[model samples]
Target chain A: MLHHTLKISLVAAACGLAFATTANAEEVTTERHQAEITTVAEGLNFPWGLAFLPNGDALITEKSGTLRRVGTDGVISTPISGVPEVVYKSQGGLLDVALDPNFAENEYVYLSYSEADPAGGPGNSTAVARGKLVGNNLQEVEVIFRGAPKYESGAHFGSRLVFSPEGYLFVTLGDRYSAMDDAQTLDNHHGKVVRIWPDGSVPEDNPFVGQDDALPEIWSYGHRNVQGAAIHPDTGKLWTVEHGPKGGDEINIPEAGANYGWPVATYGVDYDGSIISDKTHVEGTVQPHYYWVPSIATSNMIFYTGSEFPAWQGDLLVGALKGSQVARLDLEGDRVMHEETLFAEAISGRIRDIEQGPDGAIYVITDDRNGQFIRISNADD
Target chain B: MLHHTLKISLVAAACGLAFATTANAEEVTTERHQAEITTVAEGLNFPWGLAFLPNGDALITEKSGTLRRVGTDGVISTPISGVPEVVYKSQGGLLDVALDPNFAENEYVYLSYSEADPAGGPGNSTAVARGKLVGNNLQEVEVIFRGAPKYESGAHFGSRLVFSPEGYLFVTLGDRYSAMDDAQTLDNHHGKVVRIWPDGSVPEDNPFVGQDDALPEIWSYGHRNVQGAAIHPDTGKLWTVEHGPKGGDEINIPEAGANYGWPVATYGVDYDGSIISDKTHVEGTVQPHYYWVPSIATSNMIFYTGSEFPAWQGDLLVGALKGSQVARLDLEGDRVMHEETLFAEAISGRIRDIEQGPDGAIYVITDDRNGQFIRISNADD
Candidate 1:
């Protein structure tokens, strides 16, 4: 068990050291802020994910489990048909949507969701299925990955999907609100982030491949519900966002076989305000690079590296659900020089998802009926 | 109640409007399809709110109710010493944080949370307060606003804070759980977004200010738990995000006395998979500009107008908690042109808050003990 305290001063100094770099307090930034808000698409029913097609259009997903073809006119084509029925529920439904890393030729699309199980088992688990674009509907739909130890709750089925440049598929799983301790276990898929091949087979060279002591699909463990994962644009390092119970949401640079210490070290308390764990910090349990205390109820994140906003060509953009806003970070070296809140009063809804489109535009989906397919561009700013 | 099915096709039409303005479609971008992940600060318990000092440092808030001043070195100062104890419970704690528009003139910071009843009343309704920053400790702390008809549940205390450029402070309120019927009532503060003066007084020009039919603090009524609100940088329009049970999370632009359906007109079912109200749309209830069929557990949102990232200069960044990621939105007008997912795999946590820093950077607060204080900058993405 890790010892946890609401220490203010002690952790302050160590936090600066963890990042290995510091911001120059004396330095001045003359750059200005100029964010424009324009409507890229009007009506979208819980557009969950975005994939920028090479043709300059985009493919989007709806939580009710529909694949949409959005063209330059913002005209959404017919539901493009051919999607499996998702057991849509609280925090469950057609979730994150992704495109093949090499979509120019194959037109393959990867979708992540809580698939309906006809197997007379638990209701749903994190599932990743692959298919190619045949006309409008998805063709050759095949299950590529499945989360294990499925259970009854819809509270924590993390079904975000991503792909490595190396072509491995990374999928996230929630602990199904049952096994808080199982997040630290290796045998079950609950509360784990897994990596698999495109064909739903475990990669032989994965972090714990062929290891008796570890789960074969695990790239990382000890996560409650991981929603966001992206490969670093510069270093290609993988990073993830994990949810905490009452607080303790985390952004981690997950290493293979590392224990994240769920039901253990936590800055947050339980839902009923119970003690989060016996301790807050434990040796051998990986510490998060950063954490939120009051809990923003975070959703999606992206690194902006486009020409539309030249000065901001290399920055980070993250969406917050509870706080109902977006945060932009200013980094100098490895240290954050400053941080600010933008649009806290503008887009009033939980920002469900964010993506960078092929045309270099940034796209976001609001998880509301007024589930707007809002777009951001230089012109609007 | 609002029927979303009729709007589903309208949603399709909105997508068409979004496609016409592709912000980055013509640009030859430098960065490929990857995002950068960097942790700017650690040791923040629940860095609920992030704001920049004029000199470019940051002030962070923890859910335990302590405010920490974060330096560029990532070092956190001990608690600022002057915050009032919060009614920290299931969903009640030191909640949203914001800066006074005149922070440069008078280091005033505003906070909103469910405060324990010093007078020995129920601790459910939220309150807003302001204090001056003198060194690390807050001075002149004053209760600027208070909620009415205090209930008992810790849930639905939409306590996020925001300040309009017009000098009015906006406070989001929750239905405090199934107080769905409470949203339609004016005597209670259950489900409504309010506009208030800085001194804890009701604004005279408020939409429902003089009317005996509604609470004086009410800016708009008929809302569920409105967790997100923002002021549009261009139009200065107030946008809001509200959560519906099972599915219908919503975004609304407020009109005086407008009704946003809670128990009615949602795409979502109940937690037990039951119908909320037989209707998905109503004649008088306001409709969401966008919605998620499957809820994303919406939180805060931000619109970017920073020069640091030219590509995303004018975009919206939204955070999803249950969906566990940040979303970037490219806008053409009011519609979403594209929807993209960022940090879907990096942080396995729910996003609680998002902010843009003074140095044209992005700051994010995740809600977990491992909750994170992340900064995004030009070099990182």
Candidate 2:
């Protein structure tokens, strides 16, 4: 068990008392800092994902199947047209958007949405598509990748997208509600992270490419519902955060072909207080870097590499939906040293996504019908 | 929409750097203070309610139908023998425990549990019972009140118990999952706070005592699952916290005959993102004293008047199950002035109940199979 010996100092600014520093070695001291919050955009319909374009504008995806562009002057554009039709059901819809790595040359953008099956069944699947940005509309759009064996449930569509330094695109997928058993199988894309080339082709060196009965696009498997994914700038590794059933939210540095346990070896029980699995560890499954008991309902993540906040450089920032705050995790190598909740009292809504602006400011989008885009910067500035 | 202008101060204790007090009048400033945590008891099965006895010992109720005694020296006694048979299903079991107002002479102990229906149907209800505590067993246990129209679902049993200053017992009941519409109706006790005499009789002065259609014991109606309740030490008014559907956990001072809207004027949407009610206010409904937009999953509550924390006198302390911390609300005459999370980094599980001990210290019980009873005191002592 991990024990936290927290000592907080309360000083009255008016008293001007000379305080003594307690020399307790195991004590962790956290200095509170304030940030100036500026509203960037308002009246958004549950903005889900945000990505910075090369031209300093941002593309924001609303869960209600609308994509809008926000200019540098905090002006929101009208909903972009020519996007693919999405199943805008519960926890579905236009999920994540990302700019192509060669966006400056190719003018391409990628999107992940809950796709209604062509057979017109009740089932829906997570599908990734790419398009050329032509003014306010996407042109020449084409589906890149689609999850297999679509299910009928509208919950747990883990559709966050991140680009690796090696230029391959990584897409996180959920266990599709009642299909958690598929997470342990190699035949389906449910509850798996897939890495693919921009044109929807699996790379030759993919981890499960040659394995019998395994999907060639699978990078890592057995995730429950990964909503956050970011590349560690120094390590060039992918760090992801996933929501657990009832309790156990986890953060993991998913390695190639690693089996991150879900129903087989979870730290969480079922939602109805029944045991999903009695074990927290298994022989071949990988343990998480950090797991939160009594889940924070983690959303999106980013690794800070900005100059505006020197003290927070290289720290991992996770947006918490249930806790309704931005969690700043200070890491000592792979282990988390301290965790602090930022903008908790200031932001009243669920934090859906977080991004670093080009000018080194922190931008966050809230999840609500009247959600707002907020920017936070050093108050001293 | 509410806006928060928060400014936090960071002071280096060793060097008293002549801090400038920024005079932002609307800015809320919160100072972090740590407490010394001492484990009072451990290895209890999801301990729910805690009450300090006159002899300085503590009595705790576990949700799995066992009640135990903790001595002043932190030794836990074996389970007391005579607890009524409780339905230990999802979110149901032996719940809140309290002492009679005249415990010295009467030696009566009050308990709230999910009572299985007498007809042996697939249904149960929240029932209150009273008995004399004799050594290790409850003598002559008798049912005092049982909620009508027992429902099969165990999702929301809202069984917190509080005694009014006038010596009437107040019991909270839930909408019982599929019975939310009953919250708006007074014909049943599905979603209401009921005031009654100790011996299963409705108080004659109850709000709906003489009404033909309404239940005579109903004090207030239109509430969801109310998990917390306490009386204001100064005003003697009842205050409660209820879990909302998706967002909008609310704190309300429920007045007699007042409708605290649940399924009608909620700030929350349904679990599938469907609207429960778009209006946050209705003509005859009362607004919440305060609300959490993205809910903290509030549980038990208390109004502190303890001398151990002089600055916190008359404030409301709420145990947050989802946030895994205690929320201290500094109140200025019923309106919340400031809110701060306490023991967030120290307590690692869901806080189920909180109480002020006879010695003025704070005691909390965690909700888990391996739950713990933790006592918090001033670190300076």
Candidate 3:
């Protein structure tokens, strides 16, 4: 691994001639490190989420409500039309659409959206519905998971949907801005990523399985919005990312039933430009593993274990909305050695989804009306 | 002044959306504050220096030795010829170009460049020369000041030319990557902005006017390619910006005979990514008024005293290169309270110059081959 990393870094160094002088023999300051950028692909619209099919083809969801297939060849197929109606407001619309781990056999695709219900909008819940892709059309769409006791507001929907390798699905839902009390309640599913079996049955090993006051499916709580999720390549642990209002955008490895802090301890501030709560750590809520000082408006995360960029293996890949780039985090064991910008200025598009392909290459999709599905690889040249 | 400022802030508050229930209510953190960009102009090549002509028109210089004029009406005229030939390569070429403060009456324009001698490229040097514009052509070009011994390196030409309100022309020179010693030598003019009279004669009031070890025209020493220069509107201070190799892009309010720390105590490192030294406070070299941590590759600067944005009056406007925007710093007296991104992603160009026109409107010129000149006014809904 060391030799492969050095080889790839040498190749990268050759192209980054501008940085030859930047690799000082002395200690590197925050500004002195050099990172290289190469164009991967172009043309994507507010692509909000992605899921890898077993065959390596990826499904991408546009916030404007279109499910498209990004084949391994990097071509964007026509929209597959089983997506539900999305409000698509300030922070609403169709969000976090993922594919089942057994997509090749089961063909079940999962999606989360702000469900428009009669009761205000916690009526706006992170609805996890599954369907089969029947030749560019969804066949037999079923609402697999839904949060209870709707409230108002479409502001934040922690709609990222992911399935653990153990065959259980996790659905992240936001506080819906109606109340923070719902986060502590077990009967309600707000502000948590509820863990359940494929048939929407509560997991027997859930944190609060027999607790009468708590919802049996609640895996974690007090999440602002979980936009990015991926399994750790080596550890197989579930990692997630949440957006803090003004400053915090946290990356966490959550323990089951742990309460992640929101509306309380956050690096972010209120939109009125005031301190959110003068704290970023509450005793009961689990802390994030790592956080960004200035929010990158995070979404879509994956850990690199592909063979294409051997140096990048085991690193984390995160999509940033405000950063308008893909962040490649280099880790030396557990400590973050340094962070590099991978598809930053080169892509010039919001990367909403990233998935390692079966062929050891990587695919990314853009989010927005004029987005595209792009593939990233080593330059053939 | 406090009451007036409060009044304007109150008005701004009226238009600003209040903090939602979740807003932190404290001022936004410095990192999360983003600048709003307004494209004042576009279409030009490496537009480096800007001088608001007496009639409110702007004289913008392209690094290709073209002196283009941006009229008050927002029209870009054909090249105002008669600029001297420059060795246009990595860091040389038609560098800092500015006009006399009395340009309306004198028709005199000043230009600086690293011209190629017969031996090789005379390293970056400030050769203050004047040219008179007669219709489409410049007539009777004369050399005002020239470096004694030419350098052959094609870099570090601090060419910004600005005259104080009292008519002392301040010229910035660069230390062609050799070190601070070159700038310290009396015979060499590599890293000094020589201050002189209109006729290029040494001013008796200069700090080293009669010193045997000092150059008569030396105003300040040890600047590393000062790129931006603007006289403080109220204080009449000569402020300069010099590019630091890797990190230190300094904003210096220069004083006579001061050593402004180059090769010593730099906020930046060598271009090759090596740490040069780690000292920010040296006894002799003056400190930067302000410095950028993660450099934006800064360019020209200005102070806004316009009527349209009364609250923004007397604020410093620094052009950001790598950030591709302009920053407006809010000041509490001389202290920077906070900064607002005045021109961010909106003006899709590198800001080369910023000048407050005679009409009290602000104007900017973009850099690069296809740069444009833009005029800024109150945004009309």
**Per-residue lDDT of B1-381 in model 1, one digit per residue for the tens?**
111111111112121222111111111112112333456555456656677888777787787787877666455566787897788787788888788888879889888888766679765568888899889878999988778777778788896777777788889899887567787788888888888877777777887777776788887777778888778888887888777787677767787567777755665677897767756568878657666546777888888888766667666777778756766655545554334556665555788887788877777778887556766655322
Interface RMSD, Å, model 1? 16.0
Residue-by-residue lDDT tens digits, candidate 3, B1-381 = 001111111111211322111111111112423212233344567877777766666777778777766654445667777778777777777766677788778888888776766356534455777888776577788878876567667667777788899999988888877644586566677778789887788888898888886778888887777878888877888988878778778777788888887767677777786877766657877767667655677777777887864556777888877766777764434444334565464456777777776766666777767776655555311
lDDT (tens digit, per residue) of candidate 2 on A258-333: 9999879876778897888867678889877777656788999999888777667878999999867888876646
Best by lDDT: 2
Taking all chains together, each candidate's TM-score versus the true structure is 0.47, 0.49, 0.48
Per-residue lDDT of model 2, residues B47-161, tens digit only: 8888889998999999989888877655677788889999999899999999999999998999998999989999898999999999989999999998988888887889788
Candidate 3 whole-model C-alpha lDDT, 0 to 1: 0.68
Candidate 2 chain A minimal-lDDT segment of 10 residues: A19-28
Better of 1 and 3 by lDDT: 1
In candidate 1, clashing pairs total 212
lDDT score of residue B202 within candidate 1: 74
The CAPRI class of candidate 2 is incorrect
- Model 3 TM-score relative to the real fold: 0.48
TM-score for candidate 1: 0.47
Model 3 lDDT, residue B203, Cα: 86
Question: Share of real interface contacts recovered by each model?
Answer: 0.00, 0.00, 0.07
